[model samples]
Target: MYCYPPHPVRGHPCDNISGNYGTWQANAIQREVVVVGGGAAGLSAARTLIRNGVKNIALLEAQDYLGGRVKTHRQDGILTEDGAEWIHGGSANRLYGLARRMGVLSPRVPDSSYAWSAKTETGRNADPAGYDAAETLYEICERNSVLSQYSDFGYGKCYADKFSGEYRRNRGRRSERAAWLHFLEMWVNKDTGLDDWRDQSARDADHFTDWGLDQWDQWRAGYDALVAHLKKDIPAGTISMSSPVCKIFWDQGDKGQVLVVTQSGVSYLADHALITASVGHLKERQDSLFEPALPRAYRDALAVTELGLADKVQLGWRSSWWGEPHYNLNIIFTNDIQGEKSWLKGIMEFLTIHNQSNMLQAFVPGEYARKMEALPEETVKRHLLSFLADVTGKSIPEPSFFRRTQWQKNVWMRGSYNSYVTVEGGNTIMRSRQPLAQAVEKNGKPVLLWAGEHTHTTRYGTVDGAMDTGEREAYKIIDYMDATFG
Candidate 1:
């Protein structure tokens, strides 16, 4: 249940043995634990350690601000969430519980709403053919037994195989089938942030346990409020912002103290270190970031664990264009069917920000999201405007203000969140969640630990998962400290 260093020691060597070992002890910048990353996991770890009475700790964050991907941006008078927006499990969720305690929980919105965009019509009301397709897809989602049959296949492939066969048998037309496929793809993309359903695992897709029917809730004050609440009890100067860790040197000469060096050249020596960096960041910098390099098993795990992109483009309008207030406007672009040549393939759902009348947020997932990140700001804005015009069948005015999240471009966070890519008979996620090392050292010395959403198998890609992992790593460090000092 807990992990600790192998060799037990009394009080910290720097505190008790400083006078005896002056040369080494005096020069070392000592800490009981060092947490890398200031996101949900890092903050949760810090809170856990502080609650457990561990005082000497440092939290280093690559970004200037806390809350890794749970960021909120304000444009004009409206507030828009650029990163995480929903508390997925409502009251039953751990993050939701924290939000309730913090008094930031908002009213629950509908899980989702649907709309169809065709050549002649574009609105919530769908034609008979479109309605049938939507209903069929909904049935597929609700029927877990049906989905379980294709556990070994890619979700997209399986759906296509089954749905296509059914449509053909029912005398469905080509255009109607295309409409169904488009809707299904958009739905899948919205849920998993994967552009192609083929990239998702059929088994893993159905593995997620829905906490409740009305599980989605937004924060009234914003996600930053939760971050601040988590840090409320933490000692001042505990977190170092704009401090990106460059290298971690563990199991150093003899005494085995771990050294963490940031990009700015500051070094920290700690008995144990918890690395809560996003999997994307780790994937990007794994080779050169660690002094001795990560183990081959860890490397292999990282390779198999896929990180995905889900970028948001927030538009602030002078007036509301949507007909009514809905949780989300599911845009099924069926009119412009260029097969593989369409640029609108990745654009899926448009979310209505809570109480922000003038704000509408569009999500771009998968490879299209990556491509969107590379395009110039003006170009992206133009493309979105044109798409909206086409969907609404009315000329739309340029937004009063616009902003997009470039998670992939951010050196600190390479993608929005973790995604499951099917690998034949492989449980890459479970393997990746394993401890980086039993105790971070072969000789019972403390070294490095990992915590992130990617490290939580059941709740991967959720805020609660990140918070849970942070607390888990914190407990590991606490146990290590207790065993070492006893």
Candidate 2:
């Protein structure tokens, strides 16, 4: 049987820095920069700072481990992931180069062939042609732009508005535009857990460039190896986990020294601090108390930025039932056959990895991801098994082991990484997410900086995005320091 970690309670289980109350006494350490979150973004920022000879730095992570979203688990002789499973893209991913350099990347993944099966509306095996349709839809999306598809947020303006007369006429004949739009929505739903892509601003989708599309790799060692590699260079004590930063006392009344206070009362004073916490973590208005409060722009942005949800469910069977030890399997459009009426069915995409030994996983996104997080173990297992049997038309026995992650409820993450359309007052708020790029000066001194995947307009919601953002933040700080102190 695969042993899992003790279930965590909301806000407390992995609170590493919470117990060290003595560290909160307003340490008089003169640090140049303090990086928070210790995830890929923060760790990358800290590493860059160290490489640049900025020794007066500190990192804070809320979890016990360094890798934030990249986590690997081993169960029932099957390697699994509680967080990130695949590297997402191949050579196009910036992390790809870094991973290869660090020897944590695999150039060729094992033969993981996916067999997609969808159900008809009647709970019967849908036409085998459904996969072909899905394949055609994927090709169309790749050929056309997502931004141009649903130009008007759900019927505001028809697709005709964005096309020429001839093209518009052709699209209008069979309402192909609307049909194509539905396929696009399905694509987004399965890929990133974003539902109703029409609601997302076209501009947000406009700037998207998928670097992971070229080649993809899955790490058997868990995506966390990237985090491990990041920490290997930094001194062990530089990063502190289990510390929930409660209040940040920055630019005390404009000229006062900046102080960061954790829930346990540890305070770290620094000349400047990079707040790299997730956008969701900052949602609970009362959770992070900012002394003197954040700027109006930041407050506005925080209120409008939407945090999307993504969750993973891994099941380990006692014996290899699929009869293949190394093949990646995926079942798409299973809902069409199961006749299921649940929100999760909309975003269910299963990908199998982990030594392929009867271990399978379902990548649930959006509302379904949220629901799965709240389900009982047995209930979740039964539902998954039943669905699998229907798709394969075979009675697949129950999985001996079960593990599911409720990332939406995870205090550290709150929600999965998603690039949302800037909502009402979102533009002003997005500026606050930027790192030193939007540095504010107080009495001829800049006291605050920001950096995280959310802050990057171009590279948001991927490992490469986080890495590039971290690197950018480091350069911004370095440039500012050089110009000011030099």
TM-score to native of every candidate shown: 0.85, 0.81
Candidate 1: tens digits of C-alpha lDDT, residues 1-486: 112123222231111211222333345578888999999889999999999999899999988889998898875567888788888766678778777877778876554452323332244333345435544654565356866776666667656766676566556666557766677676667557776777766666566555753467878978788888888979888989887887677766676777787665667888788999987777767755676876656666666556778888888777777655553555555566453325456765566667775668877787778877888888888877877776666788878989988988887787886556455423344322453323356367557788888777567778888898899888877887689786
TM-score of 1: 0.85
Off by over 4 Å in 1: 1-28, 111-148, 165-173, 212-214, 335-342, 421-432, 435-439
Candidate 1 pairs with clashing backbones: none
RMSD of each: 7.5, 7.0
Model 1 whole-model lDDT (C-alpha atoms): 0.70
Q: lDDT per model, in order?
A: 0.70, 0.60
Scored against the true structure, residue 201 in model 1 reaches a CA lDDT of 66
Query: Weakest 10 consecutive residues, lDDT, candidate 1?
Result: 12-21
State residue 331's C-alpha deviation in candidate 2, in Å.
5.6
Error of 2 at 299 (Å): 1.9
